[model samples]
Target: MMVKVDRLSYNFGPHWVLKDISFSLDKGEFLFLTGHSGAGKTTLLRLLYGALPVNRGRAQVAGYELNKLKKRQIPQLRRKVGVVFQDFKILPRRTVFDNVAMALEVRGMPRPHLERRVRAIVRAMGLETKSYSICERLSGGEQQRVAIARSMVANPELILADEPTGNLDFDLTMHLMDIFKQFHTYGTSVIMATHSREVLDCVPEARILHLQDGRIVTDSEPGLEEDVQ
Candidate 1:
């Protein structure tokens, strides 16, 4: 399994954000986490990536127990798990190539090999012409693509995306979904949090984990009405 959560729970001060959640994801599986704005989707993703400490129960990702993960091991953990933020967290002043290449550079990849890899990924994302363009000057869709390119540049085993297509139009959202599907076809596990019905319709085969009020109320194929709570 790529991820496993057994009776996981989390809280902020006196407020509980997640409650006794349990689920598992296989190595190449694509799972969609659907919920309203505060349904704990983002929090669950954060927990999986070690951004938030596990306060109760067991949670393991990529073979590492998040509850026992050390602060010093965070960088190593992040290297194997890529994340795409809802905000498209690309550096505004950096060029497209630089943004995508940063991850490889941090891993001490040789400059020549790094350039080849980054260029190939940028081209795959249809951003080859904008390789030297500053991110802030790009449109919303372009910036979102740049962010996806950066996350995928390292070819991590698991990708956690939080509302990746929230700001995109119908065309752009479908385009991004196609890109994600291509990656999934190559055996990368993906967990995307979204509230878009269009996304659900596009990936009918993917499993849906519907969250409500910090609890999973459903986990089944898209469009099925089964309630798992």
Candidate 2:
């Protein structure tokens, strides 16, 4: 299994954000997380990526145990999992090339190889012409593409995207989703959180997990059952 969760729950201080949840994802599977804004979609993604602490439940991602994960071990886990946040988290002053190359740079990848990899991914994202352009000056969709290129450059085993097409128009959204689908076809496991039905239809074979009030109302996929606390 690429991912496994059991009785997961989360909160901010006293208020609960995610109730008990359970799910398992297999290698090469593409899963869609469907929920309203406050339905804890992003929160669940965060936990999976090791951005948030997993205190109440068990989660195994990319062979690492999330609840027992340590600070130093976070980087190790991230090496196998790429993430595209709802918010574009690229450096505002950095060029698109720099932004994309940063992923490989941290891995101690050689500059020559890193440049080639970054350029390839930037081209794949249709940002080759803007490689040297600063990110802040780009349009919202362009910035989102940069974020995606950065996430995909390393070719991680798993990709976790949170509403990746939220800021894009129908055409552009479809384009980017096609790129995601291409990666999934290459055996990269994907768990994308999306609200657009169009985006969901982009991948007819993907399983859907629908959330409501931080609980799973439906997990339309085998191997995972809804566990609402």
Which runs in model 1 stand beyond 4 Å of their true positions? 226-229
Q: Please give, for residues 1-229, the per-residue lDDT of candidate 1 as tens digits.
A: 9999999989988989999999999998999998878889999999998988987989999989998899998898889898998754889999999999999999999999999999998998788999999999999878988998999999999999998987788987888899888889999999999888888777777999989988888888876845322
Evaluate residue 46 in candidate 2 and report its C-alpha lDDT on the 0 to 100 scale.
95
TM-score of each: 0.94, 0.94
TM-score, cand. 1: 0.94
Worst 10 residues of 2 by lDDT: 220-229
* Per-residue alpha-carbon lDDT of candidate 2 for residues 80-190, written as tens digits (9 for 90 to 100): 999999664899999999999999999999999998889888988888899999999999999999999988999999999998988888888989999999999999999
lDDT of 1: 0.89
Q: With candidate 1 superimposed using the best TM-score fit, by how many Å does residue 201's alpha carbon deviate from the native?
A: 2.1
- How much RMSD separates candidate 2 from the native structure? 3.2
Q: Mind sharing the TM-score for model 2?
A: 0.94
Give me the runs in candidate 2 sitting further than 4 Å from their true place: 221-229
